[model samples]
Target: MASSPTIRYGALAQTFHWLTAVLVVTAFILGPEGSEDEVFRGADLGRQAHETLGLAVFVLTAARLLWRLADRRPDPPDVARWMDIASKAVQGALYLLLCAVPLSAVIGTWLEGHPVTLLAGIEVAPMIAASHSLGERVSELHGLLGDTLIWIAGLHAAAALFHHYFLKDTVLVTMLPRWLKK
Candidate 1:
């Protein structure tokens, strides 16, 4: 099998990175607003889409992690020690949030005695016993985590841009697909 370029991620890694970003933003936009009852009731396309996208993010993250274990990543551009530490911290937080956001949603929905509704008439029934109050709290936590994820991701993008424009480094370019790298 061919290996990735020493200075750039392979196409698969680039694809996963960009696709995850799109899915996260789209899911955030589609998230239903209102009380738990209002969100769970009726046939809401937005809610269904949000749940589906969240699930997709969770699955994609798992796959990306697995791929990373075997894939050789591009070497990091030369930078200050602090910058490297901050970058790793942000990346770790993003991964944690990616997993937590979806899990909280599932746990919250299940605890509230509701099924996780998805597109194409699919539904995942609650596996845990009902605890309406705790469910509400967990659902609220999910919202907070979602917001945090967006903010951290924004910071990550800004850092990449800074490296690209100010530092004149390959930090961002290393992840760009062939078409975008030109």
Candidate 2:
């Protein structure tokens, strides 16, 4: 919360953010294809792991939004207005996708008529679609949104690294895990 170059994230926020990032990267690396394909295209355990972690990402992102609102975030490096706008635009896009991608995914899965099992046997009620075409359409939309999210997140990471090294700023410190850096 301090308007200084200090760790702005609380313990809970940092833990959730880093852990979720790990799971997200793992999921992205694995891709969506499970062992079996063709008729039965279910999440399988690993993909379920991905989707489950996605839901957690949604929650953590929500928490981060709240934390950001509660505390004044430090500014990016002193730069040109256009550069700052670009940085803010990228961050805003990331935040929007972070929230939206999970929502669409959850809705699409439920519409496809499957119980979204969580860490154990916990499941959410199906948000059934009116028709198969409708379900597929929504699912397609979800996939597109997810792909866009990945691209945006890449931009986010690249910008962070640029700021940390080239721009010589403290921008990346808040998000780095404890052991990763001082």
Candidate 3:
């Protein structure tokens, strides 16, 4: 399929982009937050849903990365040299975290000897024997990573808006929905 030659992303690339964004944001929102005391809130179902969402995000992101490698999408906008470098760096970090966050949670959950069930109730067995202390530590790291993803995502969106409104560039336009395009 031919992609837009100028600033528009191809349909497949745009689909992957938006799907990943929505899943990542949803996983962040559904995942546990704040103190350990308030983490699960004694809600087993909520925790299960959170775990399932994280796993789904990991799977989707893996496919997205593969798609990205194969797709001929629009190139980066003509921004300043420094901005280009910074943008690439941020994008790289976001992709890294997209994989890392969910994998960490899975490992942590497995190590804790907790059952990881999918949305359909398929059980994922533990990789290690029950070790509450270690699992707790890993869980802390998982929470930290999730929080960092949220912060970075905020910065990313803000930067896109800045580019579109202030710099008057194609950076944001390329990724916007067709109905929202100016």
Q: Which candidate is the best by TM-score?
A: 1
Q: Where is the poorest 10-residue window by lDDT in model 2?
A: 34-43
Q: How much is the lDDT of residue 153 in candidate 3?
A: 83
- Stretches of candidate 3 exceeding 4 Å from the true structure: 1-4, 33-43
The residue-by-residue lDDT of candidate 1 on 64-157, one tens digit each, is 9999999988889889999999999999999999999999999999999999999875999999999999999999999999999999999999
How displaced is residue 38 in candidate 1, in Å?
1.4
lDDT of 3 by residue, 33-60 (tens): 6664565345456666788888888888
Deviation (Å) of 179 in candidate 2? 6.7
| lDDT for model 2 | 0.69
Clash count for each candidate, listed in order shown: 0, 0, 0
Candidate 3 local Cα displacement, residue 148, angstroms: 0.3
Q: How far is candidate 3 from the true structure (C-alpha RMSD, Å)?
A: 2.9
Clashes of 1: 0
TM-score, every prediction: 0.96, 0.79, 0.87
lDDT of model 2 at residue 102?
A: 80
